[model samples]
Target: MLAIDFQHVTKRFPGVVALNDVSFNVRKGEFHSICGENGAGKSTLMKILSGVLTDYEGDFFVNGTKTGFTGTRDAESVGISIIHQELNLVEELSVAANIFLGRELRHSFFLNEAAMFAESQTLFDQLECEIHPRQNVSELRVGDQQLVEIAKALSLKSDILIMDEPTSALTETEVERLFRVIEMLRNEGVTILYISHKMEEVFRLSDRITILRDGQHVKTLNREETTPQEVTHLMVGREIELIRLGKGRQATEPVLEVSNLSLLWPGHARGWKLKDVSFTLRKGEVVGIAGLMGAGRTELLECIFGASEDLPEGRILLNGEVVNFRHPSEAKEAGIAMVTEDRKRLGLFQQMSVRENITICTLPDSVSTGIVHSRTEAAAAKKSIDELGVKTATAETAITSLSGGNQQKCIIARWLRTQPEVLLLDDPTRGVDVGAKAELYQVIDNLCKDGLAIIVTSSELPELITLCDRILVLCEGHLTGELAKKDFSEERIMELATKLAD
Candidate 1:
């Protein structure tokens, strides 16, 4: 029996056709995985299936019966649940409240808070999680929050569950727990539809996989009949050759240096976020920071860029001159720029046009006599779009209308306009697709060859290995080890990253 059957589904937005006659099916009691590049209509198709999108050209069958779900509640009424990639929980509410939101138990006109907490505790027990039901969602870490999302879906008693990039923010141990929960669900005859960019996870858990490209259905293949290489090729419709640095740059003079850097952590158990850390960067050199989730990678970059919540205790040197910047604008004035990891939240101006976002930080350059020049701004935006190969209809298009990769390129272009000698990238390829990742790698390489110094942090070790001349490993706010390119290995990096500080 089929769990879902989507026939000739088409969805359109103002400036783009998101999905064009996409058709696919999921079998009952099977793990079905979907593979695609960014902006390939994977999320749009999922939205349609989960009833988050109602206006579309399609006929869908649920449990062998044709149905048109008007809203998310309508889909939930028929044993369907979805966990979005971006978390959807209220920070001020308790875990149990988020889990039972809008479906509160009642005792003759009074809220049954105890009953809801009990049920939420039971669900957490089933998932083998130690999260307390009454704890505020804000106090929990991102991985725990993801578990709450899973628990919320499980509470619905849905036979069909859809997970979109559920492991994006999870730790390795948390991922193991999630996999066990998935196994339990499958054994109970629940159908799973999973979406992720990680090839290993898709291959390991999926019984069958469907590939999509440019908002069109490409092919569906059984797990044993296909490989990751084939799926990647189908996802981008081309082979991607990532550019790699052959050797370390042999520059002599130091361009940037940090000495005795320490950031205090207030109102937390950990006394410090970073402790007496030091590093140096040279012209034409790329340094990579390797660490686990709370190893102070992002915090270190924030300290250098003058964006940290608290001023750090450190001495930063630029071109052999001691520099202390109190704000990010001052750092930009000193020829330093940073590209943030959280693209949507930190980097993008969603309501503005592509041209406006590209030139927002450098408006002074396009101004004369205290008046902004529209032609100058447009010319700068055009240069960035053309140089970065941003795929957009026009410079006036909305910034949010582009794909994740293109949006990221615009962010980089914004920083490039600052004409900085030092660049800091925090997980530059976090949610980007394979083809765009290759292109970004080439761009970084080219920039380094042109005498730009860079410091990058990434969760994925392979990416750092491919781009960095030297890798510095951090653990518990301490610098554990540093490895040259020749000594680079995942095992070694992981060892240092997990080491506990004294």
Candidate 2:
């Protein structure tokens, strides 16, 4: 039986046509992958199917029966579950509590902790995960948290699963575990609609591939009959063109350097989360950090910017002198800034306005004698809004009102106001739409052209390959390998990233 069927499905948002006359189908017990560029309609289609977006024009059939979901509950009731790219678990709740949140096992009006733990353990055993159900959700790593999410879905007896960029935060070992779970689901006749940017993972796990470009259905190819290069072309809508434009001929100088750089987590495993990791970033260059999740990529950036301890076990030097920063203010004063990975948790002040968010990190520049000049702040905000193209109702509008893409732009604008010589962005484009991705790329390029040294880390390999002048791979919290622009390749980087060498 056909597990999913769509005819002439379409979804639109203000200033964007998310999906246009899209038609597709997925078979029972098949692992299907949807591929597209940054602004491609892949996510839109998933949202419509998962019932996250109920307002759409189309006919959708599940199990060969026509149906339309009014909300997420409607889809979940019918054995449909979506594992979003951003985790949705309650951080303060225990694993067992999250897995059976709404439908808790109870006896005589009392929550049955034993039953919940037993049930959750069964689900974890099935997924081959080792996390305890009693553990607090906040205590688990990002990868482990994702596994909990999967267990929650399985507990629902879901027959159809939709995973959006599920492996983006997973390490290689975690990815292997996820693939094993996927294989188990397929064997049990569960249909999966998987979306990912990693070509190798797509080919390895997907039995069929659906390509979408610019919100339109492009093609559907069988796994046995198509190659990665062909699929790449279909999703890209062009030839495999790689242009390493600013390398080989560019001058290299000690733009930024760190020695014995480290950061300490008060009560964690060791005295320090980062153990003397150090490197030099040169002008007109992009240094990539290729590490598994929890390899201290974000922590390393935090340490460099003085948000965390600047001197954990080592010293930092800008130009040619040692620098110490006890706070983020000190780092900003030294001409350094960082864009955090978990934007909602660490980067953006959620209750502020878009103008305020863009202007918050730059108050000193807009202030005169401890007095904040609204006119000066507004002028600065307007310039950033125009340059970064942040779509908003007005400069005074709330930041929480903007979409995820535009909110990212505001953060970029905020850091731009500081005018730092070295900028650090941790996964700047994760979960952003394709259109916004292209715009962010242009912004990064412009920053590099202005002679600002930028260092970035992303789970997506394509972003690193296409954007970086040089890529650095890290493994197990150690610098593994360095690849110049000419030496970049997915296979080679994977080898180096998994290998240990500084």
Candidate 3:
């Protein structure tokens, strides 16, 4: 019998039809994957099934019986649980408390703290990770927090599980461990509904794959009968060519240089967050930083951009002039701009308009006689929107109205308006789709051709191999190895990324 059945499911929002007549069925004890581009109704469909959106028009069946869930609690009451893409854990609570929240063990009307901690530890052991249950959720890194979420979902002991981009923040070792746990669960008859933008994960774990685009169902095919290329084509309705930017163009003289850079970690045993890191970036070159999670990739970028809270003991040079920037504004004035890793949390102004988001960085250029000129700001925004190919109904529209890919493009546009000689990007394509990723690659290539020096970091090794002229590998706050374009390989990069610091 089918474990899940959706008949004529349709969902509509204030200005969008999120899903239209979507129908699919998952056989019991099977791993089903749903693949689609950003803003393709994949999340909406899952939300409806998981009871986050109860007003949708649809008929759902669980194990041959008709079911309609009023909320997530109702879904959880009947063996359904989901791990959201954006984490839903309370920051102030301990890991154990967050895991067993609202369902804590009780003994004689008192909370059973010992039992909950022991159970949380068991779940962590099952996943083959070491995380103390008493640690505050906010104290852990993003990757570790992601593992906690996985453990919480496992704690439910649900028969049907929904995982939405569960591995987006995980490291290679963590992902491998997760796959082992998934396999064990499948063996125990737990059906999984997986959603992800990574084609590799989708192809690796799926028994059947469903494609959705623009609020409509496309097709469902057995995994053995499909290819990643075919599935990507269905997702975006086009062929996406891999980007290769390190062609015949030669790099010019050094535009930015760092020497003997080190950041001290206060109140920690390993005193440095970055250790004696040194590199030279030339104009018309894209240098990629390759590292595993907690290897200090983002911290390195933050140090260079003057956004790090702890000052580093280092020397930075811009065009042969020694400079020290105590703040990001100083770094910006010195022709350096950065796009942070978490766009939604750190980069974007969620409540602002697209035009305002793009033009806020350069308001001085759009002011006349101590007054902001609306026409000047709009003109500049229009130029960036055109150059970056940002898809929006109008420049005055809220930035949140756009898709993830387009919202990212807007952030890049904001930095481009500064006309910096050096650009720092932290995981620029984290949650973007294939089509938007290709577009972003093109944009980066064009910027390099125009003599802009760029430093980029990504968790995906293939992305660095394809786009960078050189790759620097960091492991545990130290520079482990550096590979030229000619020496690029996933194996070599991984070796360096996992090597111990000397």
Which candidate tops lDDT? 3
Identify the candidate with maximal TM-score.
3
Model 1 agreement with the true structure over 1-502: per-residue lDDT tens digits: 9999989999998878889998889999999999888888887888898899999998889999998988999999999999877667988999999999988889999999999999999998887778999999977656578789989999998999999888766645567778999998999999999988888889999999999898899999999999999999999998876465644456567999999899999986989999999989998988999887778888899999999879999899999999888899889999999998767667999999999999999999999999999999999999999988787878999998787668989999999988899999988876677777787888888888888999998877888999988999999799999899899999999899999756
lDDT of each: 0.88, 0.81, 0.89
Model 3 segments more than 4 A misplaced: 107-110, 369-379, 389-402
Can you give the TM-score per candidate against the true fold? Answer: 0.91, 0.81, 0.93
The deviation in Å at residue 256 for candidate 1 is 2.2
Query: Residue 474 error for model 2, in Å?
Result: 4.5
Which of the two candidates, 1 or 2, achieves a greater TM-score against the reference? 1
- lDDT per residue for candidate 2 within 1-502, as digits (tens), equals 7999989998877646778999989999899999887557777788888888999998999999998989888999889999876678998999999999888999999999999999999998887777899999987766678788888888887899999888766666678878888887889989999988777889998889999987899999999899988988887766754444454335368877877665666776555566667788987677877776666777777777777644466888887778767788888878888887766666778888878899987788778889999999999999999998777768877675555557778888899898998889988886664545766877787778768888998877778887888887766566777798789998888887677654
Clashing pairs in 3: none
